[model samples]
Target: MTVPPADNPARFLGRADAYAAARPGYPAALGAWLEEAGLLSGGVADIGAGTGLFTALLLRAGARVAAVEPNPEMRAHLEASLDGAVRAGQLSVHAGTSEATGLPGGSAGLITAAQAAHWFDPARTVPEFRRVLRPGGRVLLVWNDWRAAQTPFNRAYGEVVRAHTGDDPLRVRVLEDELPQHLPGGFERHTFTHDHPLTREGLRALATSVSYLPNQGDPAYPAMARGLDAAFDAHERGGQVALAYQTQAFLGCLD
Candidate 1:
């Protein structure tokens, strides 16, 4: 697929290769919990299913999925990589965003947005979720929060990101009342903690995968790469550095 227009939501363009190769996968426990809770019984609408990471997990847990994404590059990677599931009728990819998913009304009993809610407008996305979900259907908002952890490598990585963008790399940076205000039914949060170990090449890919930081082609990328290298050298053990991540999941019924 061709890239999205510059005026559109094309932030993930030009980095899909790095994004798919290095972004952290979700915790397996989350999938198990969702399956055990019966949330994965009916089909799932994996909103903002970038590169089909979380969508792949949902499929493994025996749920059919409609993986919806907006960026053409990201969606194309998802479609190409998960073509087996697509061919088997276990998966379908659609061109859409969180606020305006092109899924049918009441098409899914569970709606999920992993590592993506921060990109959505809750005022619009919340109601759009309700529109696609059946009565009593649930919504799950997920974020793999590396910022929640405090470790030497994590701090160093954050410093590089902050130096480049003047913003926290892994934080959603949403206002306090951004989505909470719209969740009249309230929400429950589940946390799963883990470490992701990366090689030198993997570390570089991880840095490039971040949308806020200077990418490989950017003029400032050399400086960013140096900072990341120093960080890695200071913390690497057996040729890898482990980054801590806390997968935060907020669940609620939107009916």
Candidate 2:
């Protein structure tokens, strides 16, 4: 599918590619968990699909997918990755945000937000999700959070990000409050943790992908980079760093 240039005034446009490369994808365990819970059937909506990371997994699991993403660059990456599958109509893309998905009401059997729910306005997004989903449809909001404080090297890296970006971890802060009230009755929560090894380059890319990071030419950018390098040097073993994540998944069924 041909995509237009990113026109959204959001800061994510510039870092979309970095995000695609650096960010971890949802765990295979999540797919199993969803299947065991009987939530992986009919059609699924990948809210904030972002480069098709989680979207690819949904496709691999034999789920029909509707990708809703507002950023054109990310959408383009998704289209490029899916290529012929998209042409054959196995996947579809919509230029929309979480709060306004632009899909038909009662069309989706499952909805998922992977690592991008924090950017959503829950007040609007929750209702919109309810509209798109069929009765008994499930919503899964998930994030892969680096366990920065558990290790010295990770903590040091976290400090650098805090000092430079002034933003907390990428996990959505509203899930705790919104999930209880925003979701209709019959809600449940699940969590699955996993680890992935990262090289110095991967760590740097992960840090720089944040929306708040300064670009290459900016003076603060170097400071941010240097800080990240120091953290990696401190804990890197065998030319790689062990990055651990507390991957969390929250699931709820819309009444």
The top-ranked prediction according to TM-score is 1
lDDT of 1: 0.83
lDDT of 1 by residue, 1-255 (tens): 122233335777888999999999988999999999999877899998989889999998899999999889899999998899999999999998877899999999899988876677666777888899988888888888778899988998888878887764324533335557435577887899989999888998998987767888899999989988999999999999999998888887764
The per-model lDDT (C-alpha) reads 0.83, 0.76
Model 1: residues >4 Å from true position, as ranges? 1-8, 169-176
| True lDDT of residue 162, candidate 2 | 78
- How does residue 198 of candidate 1 score in lDDT? 92
All candidates: CA RMSD (Å):
3.4, 4.4
lDDT of 2 by residue, 138-204 (tens): 8887777775326666577678867875644433344465666445655667777767677888887
Number of colliding residue pairs in model 2: 0
TM-score for all predictions?
A: 0.93, 0.88
Q: Which ten residues in a row have the lowest lDDT in candidate 2?
A: 1-10
* Candidate 1, backbone clash total: 0
Error of 2 at 135 (Å): 1.2
